[model samples]
Target chain A: MTERLTLALDAMGGDHAPAMVVRGAEIARTRYPQVDFIFFGRESEISPLLDRMKKLKAVSRIVHTDEAVSSDDRPSVALRNRRSSSMRMALDSVKEGAAKATISAGNTGALMAMAKFVLKTLPGVDRPAIASFFPTLRGETVMLDLGANVQCDARNLVQFTVMGNAFARSVLGIKEPTYGLLNVGSEELKGHEILHEARQELSGLNLPGRFHGFVEGDDITKGTVDVVVTDGFTGNVALKTAEGTAKLYTEFLRGTFRSSLLASIGYLLARPAMRKLLKRVDPRRYNGAVFLGLNGITVKSHGGTDALGFAHAIGVAVDLARNGCLETMGRDFKAVDRSTPDEPAQAAAV
Target chain B: MTERLTLALDAMGGDHAPAMVVRGAEIARTRYPQVDFIFFGRESEISPLLDRMKKLKAVSRIVHTDEAVSSDDRPSVALRNRRSSSMRMALDSVKEGAAKATISAGNTGALMAMAKFVLKTLPGVDRPAIASFFPTLRGETVMLDLGANVQCDARNLVQFTVMGNAFARSVLGIKEPTYGLLNVGSEELKGHEILHEARQELSGLNLPGRFHGFVEGDDITKGTVDVVVTDGFTGNVALKTAEGTAKLYTEFLRGTFRSSLLASIGYLLARPAMRKLLKRVDPRRYNGAVFLGLNGITVKSHGGTDALGFAHAIGVAVDLARNGCLETMGRDFKAVDRSTPDEPAQAAAV
Candidate 1:
């Protein structure tokens, strides 16, 4: 049997919380029998859902908390006022060493703020960054700073690259993940001066991964690199734009299939093939975004995800814990130089 | 019969040069009989191609220029040298009032620089912006500042909105286009302070279009607004990312259809329907990107496009010139205040 581990979950977090959270845990428990859970939420709402899943109930415990972070609550307000909220309590469990990791599908900003405040940054890290993996042509590529810092300097970007390198290597199990700095163009002279500075620093790095220099937005889907690093603003926009384009493509295909009688019959014949296509690109399979560079593991599931999606998110947290992701990153951090690369006086010289 | 108009063509521009340029003009002439062309390039190369199309040759004139801007030339380098090159001479035709507009398929940076130098900005305009239209859920939407200015202040963005408004009204034929400032989120406090400042200034404007406030990257495909305005860096990245996503979708679909025998048969049966779908979203149909806010109209065709795509770009130039796009923008510029709005002392006040 595999070694047992405990994960603290924010039960009253998502859109269909408590029920979705409990059911998801039940599903996860089947795949990871040795894993236990500590659900943080209102006792009245969660206990009944746990009662329905006898197998999950056998391995789970509850930490009752009436307060919950709302989707509309500002990050600062939620952090300051909702100390006893389910999200906060779950994070606290990880901080206090009662749980190996924490998972939440609550307000993203609130979760990030609380996680940063509670768990704090790991050694030699300037700021924590959000990282997520998505399906790509070659396989999967991990991208960082999805919505964390709006504006980042060369030093911040270099730090993000380091964290992303660790995440891709440890959690994703790539022996030597390649890193790319996301920019408007792939040329050395293209984009802002900060990108150029970051490039200079990245080129001189002694990390295990190969620094791929600059990559354009399209390189993300092409799987040109194992890890993509960018500021939170551009990363968020690119992620959302890709999502929207996929939706548009689906809509177009649907309209085309329904436009004629022959097309309708063709759709029926291709239903199985279409199902395989849909499964390959299912958003549920890639539902978790982890806050990297934190003292402990914190995975944020999509807020509107169902049981299956939440279960996938739980799997992500389990994978990170089992793989000793924190330990891997910690060791890597110590080996690398932590000081910010001094800005070159003459940018044109680059 | 429509009033006759003349357009200058950079015959040596693009990957396929004089051959594609001449053929594209021939195709364009069929749709626009009232339009005439002045081809600028080596007479030896262009004259041979023009000789094949009698209809095009009847209404076309040639201006010999041995020098042509190479694809690898930097914008500043091309601007400083290459004065007598085909691309520069085409712009000069527009400046000298010999042609109503000019079109090119050369290096985008070179084209923008030459156009700005030769044509200059319209009265009260701070800088010229590159505007392009793409298919969306609801008809089409125009986006601007697509790599013309990488780093933009609030004042620059406000000017792009004004220029985009004029382009949609005149060229796209939208009576009152709705404008949206592209951002990471729709929330008032989501992005950089510059966005907030631009929003404040936009809200106070008495423009023709309705300001839809902030919009995310996904909104571009959703057709959430008629005009999406953003800084060149973000805009260029978002556009390329969307293109990459669309390509990825196509690849996945192709792989799915070939995975099984039944799927292959279904694809054959659905061929007609698929053709219809492809036509609706064909990149060729939306091949042109106009350099808005220039004193003279200039359209840039995709550098690697074929004759059909080049013709579509010519059509865009004709549409803009025939519709009096420059005159409309010039009139609007006169009515609007050109001064930058003072930056608010306290950002918290927004």
Candidate 2:
């Protein structure tokens, strides 16, 4: 018999918490049969839901924490007051080795703060970065620093590249993932001082993944590289912009299909094709945002995602733990010399 | 009779230049009979193309210049050596008051450098920014600093807000255009220090347009604000990401429809509806990117765009010149006090 892996769940997190979390756990239990869950939330609320899910109840145990972190709670406020909150307890489980990983759809800022505080950064990592995969023309590509560190220096970016590279290898199953620094243009002279310095260092790195030099915003969706590295601010903006544009185009198509009777009939015929297209670009399929460079595996689901989306988030956490992504990341970091290189004088001059 | 407005054109610029330039001019002539053109390039190449366009020949004058700026030339290199290039000569026409505006489908960096040198910035403006419109669910929204100033201070952002507001009013025809500063989040505590300071200054401005405070990246396509103000780096990345995402979705739809015979027939039935959707999101419809804050109205067309796209770019120049967008921008800048406010000590602390 295969050894069962334990996972931590923040049952009181997200928009439709407790119910969605319990249902999602039930679904995940069937999908990942070798996995067990430790639910952290109010026992009164979770016990009734667990009673309804027979399979989930057999493999899960409730921690019984009434305190929960609100979606609007500031990271600092949550950190100071919400020690017994579901989100914090979930992270504590990971830190204590009670769970291999933790999954939550809670306040992002608060989650990041508590996870960083409890789990700490991995050896040789200065900070943790939010990493997620998005659909592209060729396939899916992983992007990092979604909104963790707003203003990153050259060193921070280089570290993100290392973490993102490891992620693509372990999670995406790419033998030699190609990575690129996100910039205004691919030209050498373009972008700011930090980017130039980061480029120089990245170009010289001897790693499993190849650095493909600079890529623009469009390259993210074009699948120009396996990993796209950027500061938190630009990455966040670019990700959101892509989401908004996808929504806008989808709305336009819907409006066109409803304009006339003939068009409506056409839509009926094309419904199968449209469903395939929708499944390919569904946001729920890409729900989990992994906080890379952390010592423990922490996956964040979208606060507004549904039960299926939450189940997918749990799947991501299971995959990471099963594949030993944190161990692989640690090995990758150990391989690199983390000593800060002499800052290129020309970089400062620019 | 309406006073005729003249637009300078760089006939030797873009991927399919000289031919596309002349053909686009022909289309523009029929669209706006009141607009005249001065084509700058090698007369031998342009004259023959003009001969094929009879209507364009009647209203356009060709300037003889063998020198042309190559697409690969660096901005500084082009500025220093390509003095008599078609791009430079076209700007010279605007500088000499022979044309109200100039449009070119050429190297963006080279064009910006030449245009700035020739036309200079408006009285109270410190830098010129690239502004363009994108289709939104509500209608069309304007975004500025597409890729002009990479590293902008708080003051530059405030200036962009002023310029963007004026462009929306004069060109987009919005009387009281609402504007917002683009950020990672809408919260006051989010984003970098510069964004916070910029927000503070913009909130205090008693301008014609209402400041809608901070807006996230998704707001750009949702049409949350009429004008989205951002530093050039973020704006450019967001714009390109949207374009890339749109292409990705379109490709997915095409692939899905081609997967089976039934889907192919369904595509045929939906062709008319798809055509309508295509026309609405057609990139050619939004070809022009105006360089705001310049004394002259300068427009940049995508280098890879076809004749129709170039024609739309020319149309943008004509509209800006006819609406007195530059003059209105000048008045708006003059109305705002240019003095730097005392830096909030808290801004430095952050």
Candidate 3:
């Protein structure tokens, strides 16, 4: 039998907190029988919830922590004042090698700051990027630098590509995933100088995945590439815009069905098919946002997600740890020849 | 009767040029009988189409031009070599006061470069922005810097707010539109220093629209503000991403209906409601992307759009010109105190 994989959880992080966290762990336990969890939060709040989850309690250990990071805490403030916060303690477990991965649904900025401090960045990596999976026509595609490094240079973008490529392979199980740089237009001269420079550098490298050159924004949902690489600023905006649009589209659909009694009856007949469609595009299926380029595996769950969504985040951490994502990234980075990289540094500085 | 508004058209622009352009003009003539057109292209090709459209022929005059801007031409290359091109000639008509506005469905970069060179920017306006109307839950919202100025500072963004506010007032007929700066998060300390400074400056101004402070990406579709202001790069990415997401969502819906025979029958029963829904989200309804801050009004039609879409673009230009959008913007700019503007210039430079 394979050895059990341990994952650290910040039980007090998300909106629904101890209840959702405990229930999500229970659900995740059923899926990943060989995985154990180390919960960091107030035991008093978590113990009663754990009592309700017998299967999760069987393989769980709780570390009492009264202090927890508030959603409003700034990254700097959290780092200085909330050293013993649940989010920090969870990251600490990963740093101490007690857990293979850590999952948190805390204040994003504060979590990123703490994760960077506790786990540090991989060698030769300037900053860690937040990577997440997006549902596409061709199944799923991964995008990186969602909101991590806002103003990235060519070097930072290239690094993102490498990290994204590695994550797609390790987590998604893609044999040889293709990646593209997201830009305004597909033309070479369309975007700023930094994008052009990054494209040049990426094209010259004998990377693992095939670099599909430049891709426009529409290509993200078209599944034009396995991985879409962009700076944190644009990536974040695109992601949030897509989410808002999706919500708006669904609302419009609901309003259309409720417009008439006949349409409502028609909706009833299509309910089963609609359920399948909803499941296919469910946000919970794409909950976890992995912090790529970090020394240890770190996955950030959406703060407003429910138990099912939190469970999916746990699954993402488990998959990454089991697939040895960090080791794969290390190997990929070392394979790249950094002999003529002065251009990227100069471009990034701008 | 009101004076006729003449709009210059680059008949040779777009993929299905001359055909789509002439046909679109014919369609637009039916919508706005008071508008006349000065078509710039090969008279030999357009005369026949015009002959088929008697009403359009009555109000239109063809100005023959042998040259035209190619879709593949670089902006700088087109500006230098394509001086007598149809696109250039069309803009010339607006510059010479022959037409109140000009509309093109050619290369966006080339059109912007030529338009800027022909019509100087408004007073206190550093650059012109591409503004478009997006369908939202709260009807329609205007967004600027869609793909114009790639890198914008606090000052450029503030200027965008003024232009967008004017566009919403004059074109959209909103008495007091609410505007916001798009950012990664709604928190005051979320984005870069430029955003913070822009927010500070915007809050201090007694602008026409209510400044909604900071808004996240989702706020655009939620219609949290009447005018969504962002830099070109982020705005462009967000726009395309939303488009892609809409397409994906529609495809998912179609797939759902086809998944089962019962679902297909239900779709048939709800066909009328579905048609109404389709009409609401149709891209043709929002075809024109206005170039704001230019001395002369200019609208860019989607290059790949059909006659209906092209007609809508002409309608946008006509509305902007008839409503005196330029005058509104000029008045608003004059109202702002420019004495303490060193902060904006410094922020914009970075």
Give the per-residue lDDT digits (tens) of candidate 1, residues A188-247: 127899988999988887888799998888899999999999998888888888888888
Which DockQ values do the candidates obtain, in the order shown?
0.56, 0.60, 0.58
lDDT of each: 0.88, 0.90, 0.90
What share of the reference contacts survives in each candidate? 0.62, 0.68, 0.65
The sequence of per-residue lDDT tens digits that candidate 3 reaches over residues A71-142 is 988889999999999999999999999998989988888889999999999976898999999999898999
What candidate 2 gets wrong by more than 4 Å, as runs, is: A186-189, A338-350, B186-189, B338-350
Residue A324 accuracy (lDDT) in model 1: 88
The CAPRI category of model 3 is medium
- Candidate 3 lDDT for residue A105: 89
Best by DockQ: 2
All candidates in order of DockQ, best leading: 2, 3, 1
Better structure of 1 and 2 per TM-score: 2
RMSD of each: 4.3, 4.0, 3.5
True lDDT of residue A281, candidate 2: 80
